[model samples]
Target: MKFHNKKKKSSRGRAKWHALMTIIAVLMVVGTGCSVGFGQNSRKNWEKNIAQETVQVEGLEGEYTLLFLTDTHVVIKDSEVSAQEAEDQESRYPMFVNAEGVPAEEQFPEWIQYANEKKVDAVLLGGDIIDSPSEANLQWLKEQLEALDMPYLYINGNHDWTYPWEYMTDMGRERYLPLLEPFMQGNTAFQRLNLGGLVILGIDDSTNQVDAQALDRYREALMDNRPVIVMAHVPFMTQSALSKAVEAWNSPVVIGAGNFGGIYPNEESEKFISLTTAADSPVELVLAGHVHFYDRDVIEGEKNVPQVVGAAGYQGNAVLIHITGTEN
Candidate 1:
C-alpha cells in the first residue's frame, strides 16, 4: 500500500472544513475555560506526551512504525439528537480532558496531525473513537479518518455504539452496526491489514467478548505463519496489567480474567484467548485500551508475548510502536 502524504479533497467544499474547524475551536475554548488553572502547563506539544515501545518480530523483513491511539471519547451531537441527549453528551466532556483541559474532540485533530507529520506506516485506533453513535460524531470521525495520509483500521469500542445514558449490552452494540459499518471496512467483527511481512488484526471485543466467527478468523490468521499484532478495545488479562487495572478501577476491567471481578469471558472469548497466548502462538504483540492508563507486561505463555495497554487518548496519551524485523 502507498504510504505518502496525499490530501483528500473534500467533496463538501470549504464550507464543511470551516464548520468543522469552528466546532473544534469552540470545544478547545470551552475546555480551557473549565480547567485552565489546573491544566495550563499541559496544553499542546503532542510530541512530548508520546510513550514509545518497540518489539522484535522474527519473520518480519523490515522495520515498521505504527501510531496507536485509543479511548478518545469525543462527543459531537447533531440535529438528530434530542436536547436532553445533547446535554447528556456534553456532561461527559470533562471526563476525557487532558491536564491542559483540552477535550478529546480537540486533541484528536492534533493526534491526527502528528501522525500525518510523522507519516507512520499505519494508525491503529484500538477503540472508543467517539462517545456515542450520534450522527455528528460518526460524520466527524469519518471526515478526520478519511483525510489521513496513511492507512488506518478502526474497530468498535463499547462507548462507540452506546449512548451516554444507556448501558452497554449486545443489543445496544448491534443496534448501531449499520452506522459503524463504514469504518469497519468489511467485517464488523474482525478486520485485517497486511503491511509487508506484518499482519495487523483488529477485533471487536468492545464488550469484552468474542464470538465464534471472530475466533475462526483468528485461527485462520495463525495458519498463515505471519507475525501478528492484535488490537482491540478491551485488554486481555496479564499479571501486571490486571493488578494495575484492579487497583485503578476497583474491578477486573480486562478480558479473560473476570474470575477476579468483571464479566467473565464466554466460551469463544476463552478459546480466542487460549489461541492468542498459546505456547506456539504467532501473536507477537497485543495492543488495547479501556482501563484508561498505560500498562506494559508479558502475557504468561511459554513465549511470553508483549502486551501494551495505551492510556486514554483524550488525555493526550499515545503509543509510538516500532516493530523491527529480526531477519536481515
Candidate 2:
C-alpha cells in the first residue's frame, strides 16, 4: 500500500514538470510567427465606393524622417482594477513594462522620450489610439499626445472609430468622430497637411470607406505632384507575407481572396493599392498598423515606394521612414 502511494506521488510530480515545460515552450513562440494574432473583421456589408483615376503628385520639398506609430491601444483607468483589467493582465503582453497593461499609461512618457531622441520631423499615429472609444480613454490619449513638442497626425481604425464588428457607414463613423474631435487637427475625414515642403495625406479609412470628400483631398495632394506619404490604420491590400503567415494559424477566417486580411477590403482600398502601385502616385512609402507585427512590402508596379506595417505601438516598436530619393 505504501509503495502504491509513493508511485502515485511520483506520477503527479512528472505531470507538473511536463506542464511547466509546455508553458516555457509557448513563451518561446509568443512573439514569433506561430502566435495568435488579433484584428477586427472586414466590413464587407457596408457600401463600397468605386475608385477614380488617381491624380499626380506635385513636387515635394526637402527630405525628412517621419516617425510612425500605430495600434498603441492605450486604456487608462482608476487604481481600482476591473474584470477587464484582470483579463488584460493575463492576455496583454510585456505586462512588466506596462505595469497596468494594455494602454500602459506609465509607458507613454517613455514613448515620448524615444520620439524626442529620434528627433523626427513629425509623428504619425496609425490608429487604435485606444482599445475602446470611451470618453475617459480618448481624453487620456489626447492629453498624453498633445504634450509632445512636435507636430503629430493621426487616423482612426475600426477599434477607434466604431464599436467592434459594427457596420461600416458614414453614420457609424460620425458617432465616434466626436470622441476624437479634441485632437483632430482638421475637421475633415482626411487631412492634406503640408509640413514645409513635405506633403502628408492622412485618411480616416476606419470603416474601409474613403468617402468622396476624403478622396478629393487625396487628389488635391496628388495634384501637387510632390512626394506624398499615405498613412492609414490598415494595409491597402491582402497580399502580404505577414498577413498570409499569421492567417495560417492565428485566425484563418480573417483573410482571403475577397477579404483584405482582417482589414476593410472594399473598392476604395483596392483602388488605393492599384493607384499607389504606380510611379505617378508620388507616394514615397505607406505606413500602416493593425496586425500588431512589423512587415514591409514593395508596391507591385512602383518598386520604389514601399509599404511598411509596424508592430504594436504599445510595445515601444515604431517604424522610421527616411523619405529620400531611394527606398529605405
Candidate 3:
C-alpha cells in the first residue's frame, strides 16, 4: 500500500509540471502576438507628416466665411511619457494627438492666430476630431475650442470608432458632445448653422447607420433657399469589396452613404447616392475628409448648380473657402 501511494504522488507531480509548461508556452505566444500587433499598429506617420494649407474658394460670394478642415489626428502624450515614447501609442488610433492629451494651444498656435485674424464667421470641423477619445485628449480639445471665442462645430470621423470593433460607443461620443453643443444651436445629430446669409448644414457621416430623424431635420433646413453646405467625415461612397463585388456600389448611393456598415460598406454608398441625386434643394457644396489626399469634384445639379467636394486638411492645413454671393 505504501509503494502504491508513492507511485501516485510521482504521477501527480509529473502532471503538474506538464500543466506549468503548457501555460508558459501559451503565455509566450500571446505575448509575441501582442508585441507584433501593437508595433504594427503604432505608426502615427499620418499625423506627423500632415500638410496644412488654406484653399480659398469664392463660389456663392456670401457675406459669411466658413472654414473646412479635417483629419488633424492630434495626440497628447501622457505627462510622464516622452513625445517620442508616445509616438507608437499615438499611431495605434486615429487623431494621434489627444484633444486634451497635448497642449493644442501651443502646437497649433498659428491656426488659432489665423482664425482670429481671418475673423471667420464659423469654423466647420469636417470630422475626425481626435485620433481617439483618450480622456485627456477630449478635454484638451474642448478647452482649446472654448478659448476660440469664434463659433465652431465638430463631427465624428472613422478614427473616432477606433475602440473595440471599430465603433465609437454611444456614451463615449456623448461625453464630448456637450463641449461642441454650444457652438451648434440645437442638437448633436445635425445642425443648421445660420452664419450670416449662409446656411451651413453639418451632417454626421461617421457611421453607416442613418438616423431618419436627423436626416429629416437636415432636409427641413435644406428646403430653405439659402446656400447649403454639408460636412461629413467619410465620403458617401461604398468602396469596400463586399459592396463592389455585388454591384451594390454606385455614385448616387455612395454620395449620401453614412459611416454605418463599417468603412465604406454597400448600404452607406447606396444611400448617399440616392440622397444626393434626389436632393431637390440647392446644395451648393458637400465637403468630406477621410482620404488623406486633397481632391475636388464638381457635380452639376438642378439649375446647373455645382456640388463641390473640397480638398482634405490631412496634412494639418485648413481649407480656407471664401464664398462670394453672386448677384442674381
Candidate 4:
C-alpha cells in the first residue's frame, strides 16, 4: 500500500535503452510526437467554457458532496498510451480541443487538490485509473490516492485491464485484478457503499454483457430505504449513438467510427433498463463515465430521474454533486 514519486533516474540507462529498443522492434513506429491525441485546454479555458449545473433529488437529511473523475488514463512511461507504437490514437476523438494551453493531463492533480480543499464526502473515480494496467502505473495511482481525505468509489474502464499493446479479456483481467486491488480504496469492480444515507452501487463491467450478477447486485442494493446511486464504467443501454453530442467526447474513434456513443445492449440490458425505470426501483441517479465528456440526462421512463455521465476528467475536468438533507 506504499506509493512513491518516480525518482529522477537517468533516461539513458541500459535498462531503459533495452525497453525502448524492444518497443521500437515490436511496433516499428516511434510514437513520441508533440501531438496529444487527446488534445487539451488550459484551466482558464475550462472555466470560461465549462458550466457547472446543480440538481435536486429526493431522500436525504444532510448535504453530500460527491466528485466524479473519469478517463484519467495515466500513461506511465510518457509515451503514447500502452506504448502502442503510435501517437495519433487520440486524433480521432470527437471533442473540440482547445489545444492551445495546458493539457488536461497536466492539470489532473489540481482537480484532486480542489476536491480535498472542498472536503467532499466522497470521490467517485469513474474509470480508467491508468491508461495501461502496468504495475508501475497502479503504483502511481496508489500514490495519488493516498493524499485524498474522502472515500473513493471506483470501477475499471477498457484501458484499466489491458496491456499497453493488446486487448483485455476476462483472461487478462484474472491476472491484472489482483495487482490493482491493493492500490484502490473500495471494490474496483463491484461493491456497495452506504454513506450520507445514500446507497451507492458501483458496478464494474468491463465486457458489454449485462450479466445476472450485476442485475442481482443492482436489485439487492435497492433493498435499503435510503436513496441509491448507481455507478459504472460503461453506461447502461439507454439511447441511440450521439451525433451532436459527439462534440463533447474524447475517445469516439476507439469506441467506433460512426458509433460515437451509447451503452452496450443485450438481454441483461433489458432487465437493467426495466428495473431502473420501474416505479419500485430505488435508484435516485445513475453516474457513469467512459465517453470522456460532460453530460446530464433525465431517464425517459423513471419519473425523469437524473443521470450524469462525466467527462474523462483525468484528462481534463470533473463534476461535483452536492446533495442536501441527507445523513449518513
Q: Rate the local accuracy (lDDT) of all candidates.
A: 0.83, 0.62, 0.56, 0.62
Reference-based lDDT, residue 144, model 1: 94
Off by over 4 Å in 4: 1-51, 78-105, 183-187, 238-241, 244-264, 326-328
The best-first sequence of candidates by TM-score reads 1, 4, 2, 3
Model 2 misplacement above 4 A: 1-61, 78-103, 165-172, 242-245, 248-264, 302-304, 325-328
Q: After superposition, how far is residue 288 of candidate 2 from its true place, in Å?
A: 0.7
**Pairs with steric clashes in candidate 4:** 60-325, 60-326, 61-325, 61-326, 62-325, 62-326, 82-164, 292-312, 293-311
Candidate 4, residue 296: CA error in Å? 1.5
Q: Which candidate number has the best TM-score?
A: 1
Top model number, lDDT: 1
Minimal lDDT window, size 10, model 3: 42-51
C-alpha TM-score for every candidate: 0.83, 0.67, 0.61, 0.70
Candidate 4 structure quality by residue, lDDT tens digits, 30-121: 24332334223213444412325454555576667888777766654444344342342343122322344444435556667777998988
Clashes of each: 0, 11, 50, 9
Winner of 1 and 2 under TM-score? 1
Global Cα lDDT for candidate 3: 0.56
Candidate number that wins on TM-score, 3 or 4: 4
Q: Which pairs clash inside model 1? A: none
